[model samples]
Target: MKRQHVIGMFDSGVGGLTVMKEILEQIPELRIIYLGDTARVPYGNRSKEELIDFGEEIITFLISQGAEAVVVACNTSSANALPDLKKSFDIPLIGTIEPGARLAVSKTSGGKIGLIATEATVRSKAYSSAISRVLSKGVLPEDQGLRESWQQGEQSIALVKSQACPLFVPLVEAGLSKTPEARGIARTYLSGFDTAGVDALILGCTHYPFLAPVIRDILGEQTALIDPAQAMVDELKSVLDKLDEVQEMKAKSTVKETWKLRFYVSGDPELFQSVGNTLLPGLIQEVRQVIWGD
Candidate 1:
């Protein structure tokens, strides 16, 4: 008599609300549980070890609350901790990198994509590897044995340029997404993509979506700005669809249930709730605090 799986998602702070917003809109019937490690709001500069430890603590808490599937909405966690979490947990899980990569690869005609993320995500080269995997497909069979050449690093396929916009998370957290400072930072970081002829730019960090207006203004209408949150949710919908088809007998979250979006933060619940209300009105009227090492 186990109920349907509740989706669990986490990030360093309120930035993950972008992903949560999409899930709420797309699958309002399903139950969602969100955790934001706001006490450590910026995971972009954290070491891989720290990211793994934080990720484990957050995921464990979510699982304890009856989460059946997990979403690492934070790019840093997806980059450093996803593989480890997958091994440790038996439930179905998803991450931000692959879905974003797939979207950029599909939308970019010139195959020139740019990525803006935290220092850690850029340093890890997660987007580069993910995009390369997507680009490996559809290689012309006559072009010097396409698959072989591409695999051996001979083809000049998709080029993904990355820059770590380290200050972005703090700006977003402070509610400065619309400020002149945000625009200046974006202009400085994004000017290169114009000359590089980037057809699409992936906002690799969960926080970057809040600065989309500033980013789009700099990149112009021609350059498609990619929001990984949207891409992640789109893919999650596909995943849930397949699961529902396969597990028709299992009781699932439905419109009839009294399920509501639950929010938790390791930092100030008041601040997180304040920001979340702006992003998804009425859905985040209250938030709970998560203390560590209890």
Candidate 2:
């Protein structure tokens, strides 16, 4: 008679669906509750205070609806509000930046990485800070001496160059991911990475993955694209392993086969469902709309 373990996730719009897709692929046994704050879509230009307020409301709502742990799937919110939100919440709160940074550092061959995200995220410099923290951990005493031998502009560890692509979210939401207009914008936003010579590019925003084709054509096939969703899911798996409820649920064979998913949006549910199905293809069903302050 134990309850199902529910993990809640939220993003500004349909972007977090990418992370949910990864979670479903890796750990399909856990029930999931996803919220898309489409009424406040494109949080890229919002202030940190506003982001924090939005996150508080969303997480509180999710927790009230049986979420045990929550994932901040929007890069802007993760960059600006994650620390504060984590402190405020009692349950485990995960963000995409640290996991993405760790994975990007491991994938880079030349210790050079690129990041493309929303304006608020790039402005916060969270990815840059996270990358430095990840790289610093692996640096040895001997590496300090080798730093002097590095080229005029390169570092001995990882170098992260981040750009904010504000239009990407709208493009993906509008289902224009593969259009010529999308390619044009991708080239405009990603032109610097071509000259920066980044061997690995972290798709810093969850929505950016939908435009991966446009990005690859602009950056060329040699550059490795890092999707943080995979790393985030890996982290979620480890977190779930430690939870008593998850452990208890896993002990029952019937529970393992009875996982469920629910979708809630603060804006037009029909539009959210349409775009979600496009990104995930028939995976989304019965999206419910919830108004704020309801």
Candidate 3:
């Protein structure tokens, strides 16, 4: 329970740094350990079974490093593997989907929402399921499944549509967030959702927010865009608060060593150093490469 023991975070690549940045601002006393599977950069295209296996491997590595809790910062992994991973780990596990869904529901006045995420996230239907679970009440017996998909029906919420832009991650990573090519890609990916008349859009992938300016331009100023990072931070604090209270009763106070942040990658460390440092700001002081699947 030591504050300096480190809170572990994992992403397929750099995306999770967004969540890490927020956590540092909110809980400045805690140390952090971040690992980016940069060698396997995008988990969005992998099979569900593979993602589950990879998630377990990363969690094991983090726990071995004395992680107090873990944030599965990849949307694809959160959608496909979080449940299984949670069962395997005693530490509290948090994901991005629920918070994003909560934000979408809270921000949309029209009840018409759009989600843009990786192919794996869109295929898993996590966002729709979370939203539907919240809106599922008062359903007539006959109208049960007809009003929305079973997942959404469970939550009693309906999304006008969902789209997958698998290429967005690569584009963002390549520093194309404000480039002409990024704009073109955004225009192509967003045209369908825009035409569907959704009042708000959920930037479902953590990496998508890096492209927010272009995405906003493509979707127009009136459409509300929700970034789940803030919501996820809020959720993390709530869970940590409860855990802190329990630890207090058990007399397990946080250690007072100088907090440190560590970074690891499966690929070349130098490749990620600059971008990673930029994303994490003052949190990361060094980057080390580790052999993955070892």
Candidate 4:
């Protein structure tokens, strides 16, 4: 792919910015086009059919914007619609679940792993399935792999405990990351991980990073926290490196210069800017609206 082609990313709301931040930091020369479906935010509660429809709509919009690849930044959508999204679009598609699971598996000093996400992600069992599938394939065996120290028995990787914290996203979006209520809810949801003796915890929802401090405080420093966004960024870089090599071999290589960041929202641009600017430090430009089916 040419350097001129943009990377497309989308989420139910501003949470995807967390993933985008990592991508921008690690791959600064890659242009990005992000869409936040704020008009129909909180896709966690939406039906599978609705989520799939939304994913296709966003994918189409991004392709129209000249995107060569797409990242499904929302855990819920990734869990629900990623396969269909990939089938619907020819470009490379990335999701958060596998990366997050891999990180959890790699970091755990104990076989016990915990996953904390929205209801949809929890119900989908995406993280557990991904980890188990990877482990079963021997690509990263649980017994003697990245998390070998964490292995306890023949089972190697044990039950993956998951909790659904539906309220956390709304709290974060409301700018109440440090509020008492947020702390209370986090403590309630995460206390289970502590009891389960998980050596690593996956922050399955992108929005959960906003409550990182509170979560860390409750889970303690010894419990490794895995942020899937960073893992996804690493995965994207690997893909880009391969693409670059292939292009070079074809004698069509183009040097990647400074990349542009563009933002699109399905709701009010002002509200998105307000939240996005706070979530991501740099000044964001090219803010616009994305009307579905346009």
Candidate 1 lDDT by residue in tens digits, 97-161:
98888777666655577888999999999888888776665422223454455557765546557
Per-residue alpha-carbon lDDT of model 4 for 244-280, expressed as tens digits? 7766797874556564888899987887787677766
Score candidate 2 by lDDT. 0.85
User: How many backbone clashes are present in model 1?
Assistant: 0
Q: After superposition, how far is residue 53 of candidate 1 from its true place, in Å?
A: 0.8
Per-residue lDDT of model 2, residues 1-294, tens digit only: 233468999999999999998988878677999999999998999999999999999999999988889989998999999999988988999899999988887667666788899999989989888887875676221233334443344455455578989889999998889899999989888888878878889998999999988888888778989999988988887678667565666675433545399999999999998989988899788889888884
- Regions of model 4 farther than 4 Å from truth: 1-5, 139-155, 249-259
- Position 100, candidate 4: lDDT: 83
124: Cα error in model 3, Å: 0.9
Q: If candidate 4 were superposed on the true structure by all CA atoms, what would the RMSD be?
A: 2.9
TM-score of 3: 0.88
Candidate 4 — worst ten consecutive residues by lDDT sum? 141-150
lDDT of 3 by residue, 1-294 (tens): 433346789998888887887787877766788898888878889999999989999999999988878989888999999999999989988899888877777667556779999999999999888886655543222233434444453433457788899888887666566689888988988988767778779888888888888888877888989888888888777777777777779887655766467888887777677666554455556788878755
Clashing pairs in 3: 132-155, 132-156, 133-155, 134-155, 135-155, 135-156, 136-155, 136-156
Name the lDDT of candidate 4: 0.81
Model 1 bad stretches (over 4 Å): 1-4, 137-155, 245-257
Q: For model 1, what is the alpha-carbon lDDT of residue 151?
A: 55
What TM-score number comes out for model 4? 0.90
